[model samples]
Target: MPSNDIAPAINETQPSFNLDDYKIIVEGSTSILTPKSEADVFYNPVQQFNRDLSVTCIKAWANLYLNPKQEGKEDIEEPELKKIKIEEKEYIKKFTILEALSATGLRAIRYSKEIPNISKIVANDLLPAAVDTIKRNIEYNKASTNVIPNLANCNAVMYTKEFDCIDLDPYGTVAPFIDAAIQSIKNGGLLLVTCTDLQVLAGQTYPEKCFALYGGSNLMGHDATHESALRLVLGLIKTTAAKYGKYVEPLLSLSIDFYVRVFVRVHNKPIKVKDNMSEQMIGYMCHDCDSIVNQYLGKREERTSKKGKPYIKYGLSKAPTSSTECKVCKSGVQHLVGPMYGGAIHNKDFIKEVLRINKEEHEDNIYKTRKRIEGMLTLAYNELPDTPFYFSPSKLSSILKISVPSLKYIVAGLGSLGYECSLSHAQPSVLKTNADWNTIWYVMKEYVRMKEPNYKVEKLNENATGYRIMTNEDIKLNDSTKSISFEPNDMSYKIEKLRKLKMVRYQENPTRNWGPKAKPN
Candidate 1:
């Protein structure tokens, strides 16, 4: 039996009830419900006869509003809920979410049911049946009192009252709804959009089809079909939002197995093109060797370097070029990769606020909520760095000796706090210079302070060969045994163990053989 399957139980109070009496069909499967009124039975042949389709749709809504994931699985697990709580805590009191293509009331029902104190939710669907279903779902879930469902086509913008968040999860491509969705979101509002038409976006088919769906031309000789899809969607969304005098910065974008999801923040103030737009960077990947490089262009740099310039004279800085030759490619790079959405996932202050709200409103099990939030927030803070950037957690873990999940939470937390962050493929420890080391050290220091204030930090010597701890009065040497040649008992065995883990490295002349020493057998 599948994990989600449940055995039917007899109800003595309802003698006429039979599990097979009424078939509730949704997208793909037929579910038998115990005898119920016709109104209670929901059957939609378009949904492929699956009763759980409605439930899955509701789960997607909840995930986006409260606990969104890069992947499109349809279950609202505990991990996802924790993420939602963390988001709610930071962006409280003033946030609004617009369900641009809300079909049936699944998404609205979940939002109203789960998220506490969500100021307002505008749920709109084009079909009358979908609108009725949305209303009915709200009422059935007892969310009607809190949620307001609307009946409209994709022209939801006509009813827009300037929402802080706009979610576009259409049946296929979100292209038709883009213009309206962008116009409706308030300045600084968040937009959550999903695209299910993978074939068009992935560039496996026609260029016109891709353009019609994603609003961007497909590039040749690139395996970035998924990335291209995201960029195309983002470019289209940005263009649409610009028409309304709103500039959108894609804060988070992920291409999951089945679809692509993007979350962008609207900026309505004086464009601040120099500052915000200047930070936008792109990463180019080598088609041959898989080596990647990140390039950042300032607004001024873009303006000054409009036309190619010859070699510069002494004392004058040459204008930076938009395109650079990939060291790995050895051939001229063909693609302009991304201003890929990068940002923190969990904000600390926001999470604290959420906890306060939950405590004030609900008297139920807030402990679990708090714990989950804390864990997620901690992970985000410790692992993730500022965005409009990139950093690979896997590489960071290799250097730091920490798990990828631990780093993910930290990165997510930092992202949620409004910090720009990215994951680089480069190893954190092997960063090119001392400046990089200092930044890492500073980040680690701050993280330690937040996570464990009592933790001690020891600095390595200038030679990078050994380090001494003031707290423990221990001295570690740079030999293979990682021998501690100090007063009292020498813990050479323990020192070597730490060295073998590469947690510590030795500084030497000519070549720096920095790494933990081998442990004694």
Candidate 2:
């Protein structure tokens, strides 16, 4: 009965506890029990999206890596579907998960019921009340065999045993648990991490605190700070894992509502770990105009071995990729910004697998945030692999003091000259392109010169960023400027088609004062 999809309904038989003292919550075929007062423990309804995405990703990971079930083995129970692709080779790996801070057991319950081949899940919490709630929910839902309730500090539990997957979704920063989780996870295991303290990770107001926690600096006053937070978290993990001759490869990194979630796989490869410096970088940002540049810590080059075999040679990188004065906008103050993760944040192959899993209609409505997940992953997969960051056409329009050009126009012009342009899930109206600053400035000025000639920069102040940028002779002298077209060619038209689709490409706040809920008092 415990292995069945439908848990026995409450009140079907008498138990020790009074039914009226609590309430029932149903999410993805799993019902959980919570105190009526809610002050006894915490649950945030907004995190339903977080849980939905996690289940899908875990399923994808298992499908890609696990071995097939033996002929005589009994299949693991899953709530809405069969236990993975049974015919595939990846159906048999025992998935051991540690929900390191499962407050009310909702996520743990979902994992038990939804993700297949999960041998055990330690629904861990330091609070006795939370553990008591978990035990009651596990029994009520008939999930005792799949989930093991534990009362202990998260780090204490992680130190004692290894898990195939460790989820560290804590109240605030995930920094304190990073090293422990990395060390305790089995080689090639997965890590699901969430950091709700955006103020500490993304806000410029507390550089000391950000560095203390994540060991990095965020982009100040930039629209893309959410993405910077994602990178900082990944950077912290990459560096921490390297301490034990391990390396982390980011499978999926996302800046969800009010927080950031990243799924990374840890592997023990000393040679791969040696590439850490190349994966990390420093950013120089112009405080006023918001122009930025990055300098990687090291470089990798293709070298031929003694036996004529090709290999990658890794060594030091040159210093100071940017000058103290902003090159594009000469009037701004240059600020040293990051030691952020410089590698590709999303694995294209892994995202393709997640997208394939997302398309399944077995229980589509169960994934409440499925639409958003699809759009975001599509954009992520489209991003140029070498581009480290993004800029919006609005920012460029503001700098030149011209009426904004349509996002399509900017993207088309870049694509005409053979540059790859795509949207970023972090923010709408932003372009992640392979185009240089010169090409960008040329295009914007070209838009003004041909389309909005009425706006003039001649009378502007000499010390303004706009004035300096507009006067740059190189932008004016570029021969490509004369032949550029604002009209979308086939390549640009393709990107625009994706924008036209009926997808939730971006989301607005669902309610006033919507953010992380407070911990139970």
Candidate 3:
């Protein structure tokens, strides 16, 4: 409803014109007027005309269809077509796609025309008139002549094909069609879905109401609402897939201004599929504060000793101790549901393969495609390494033979690079204060030794607590004020040099309130 200055002006000759509410123009001597609410010209005019006269709509449609890339056009047709072409080449010959809720079929028409060797595409819709229009569009475009058209509601369409890829762009949340959509996909198949009800998904408006429609949890605060909606959708998909002996691996998920789109890969292998649904129950989240606790229902047994008596415990029959208390009303526990899906987006090899295919086929735009593929692959790869704080920082420092303060800097650096890490105080002071020191130190040392042979280290002191390793003088911390200052001597210069190499970081004790005092790196 926000004013769009670029939309075409209405045809003045037509007396019932409302420029603000509709867009009208002439295509090959035929009047093509579309109501603002209904962007598709095919569906708006079909009911008014009989089958014999409906051909008029098709004739007018041709000009708009083929010339979408004309000067100053605001339509989605051409861009979507280009994207399909890119995806097709990247996926290769075995790809199977289903437009689960096709209305007038413009998207399907564009896909068939643009993508080459797209093995199969099923265009479906619930209405008879829409189906008829789709058929007409297919014939008019002369696209994949073999494209199949199905007449069924979105849910029923899922029963027709076990597709390798499925696209769901319903008018609203697409919630009603999700279970069936998951069932329709083969293992490793791609699922692309769109949720257009921004108000509901974004959580600016009512939350419980949104949950009723979307069948998942809602978040209330900042931009997290969008992420919450995406996670909710992913959780629903995972739940549905689990019922049919499958698990969904999220490939790419994003939330734009007014929509949430997710691309996930389904896995149906016996091992990946959980035979006991109970085993899949992973955790419960506090609806009020977003606090999460772990639970396992899988068939794992353990023996426990209480007051000198040992007893065997069976699988996840009861809940574990609450991980966190509700931050809101400070009362009643939130509900638990789902063996929700979790993991990185794409496999590194799969992404590499996609990039190679794009490089060979789309030689002109290979750089652009490679960049996108690399970004996605990097994000997926980065998300998979368990959060940094999962390992004791002090223990990590011991393994890497680095000071705890230096380890903190490494942890903070990794965090700034978009890694997920947490700090814990449950372990000993030496073990608890370090970051992911071992991994960071190894990677840094490998890179540095390969790049700079001049840098060397010597052990100064060794004890039960920890050991001090000194590097050559000539390096310094980039942000000295944030780090501890060594005696401003050769040892200090060496420490600073190590900091520059990202081999260590300065850390401060969280419990000690020393009035913002700097710690050594």
Per-model TM values vs. the true structure: 0.47, 0.91, 0.49
Instruction: State model 2's lDDT.
Output: 0.80
The order of the candidates by TM-score, greatest first, is 2, 3, 1
Q: Where does candidate 2 have its weakest 10-residue lDDT segment? A: 1-10
Instruction: Write down the RMSD of candidate 3 (Cα, Å).
Output: 18.5
Residue-by-residue lDDT tens digits, candidate 2, 1-521: 01211122223244557679989887776888887976766877778888988988888777664432235432223223224455655444566888999888889989998887887788889989888888888878888887888888888778777777899999889999998898887767779999999988888699889988888899978877888899999999999999999989999988887899999988877789988998899888888777778889999888999999999889999977688887777644888877889888888977888888888743565787788788888888777766878887898788778777888888888877778888888888888887777677877877887788677787778877788887876564355355777887876787788788888766657678877898565
Model 3 weakest lDDT span, ten residues long: 46-55
For candidate 2, the per-residue lDDT at 508 reads: 55
- Point out where model 3 deviates above 4 Å: 1-95, 213-215, 275-314, 317-340, 351-521
Model 3 lDDT at residue 300: 39
Best by lDDT: 2
| Residue-level lDDT tens digits of model 1 in 1-521 | 00111112112232333335544422111112312554543332222201121222223333343433444542222221112234544422324556766665555555555555455566677667666556554544445454667766645443445665667766568888777666665555567777767766765456678755554554323434555566667777766666667676654454543566665666764444323344334555544322345454333232233466543222222343324553322435435545432223233433343334434543323222333222222332232333322334344333333334344334333333323333211123111111122233233333444555454344433321111112212211222432211121223232223224422121112225422222111
Supply every candidate's count of residue pairs whose N, Cα or C atoms clash at under 3 angstroms: 54, 2, 14
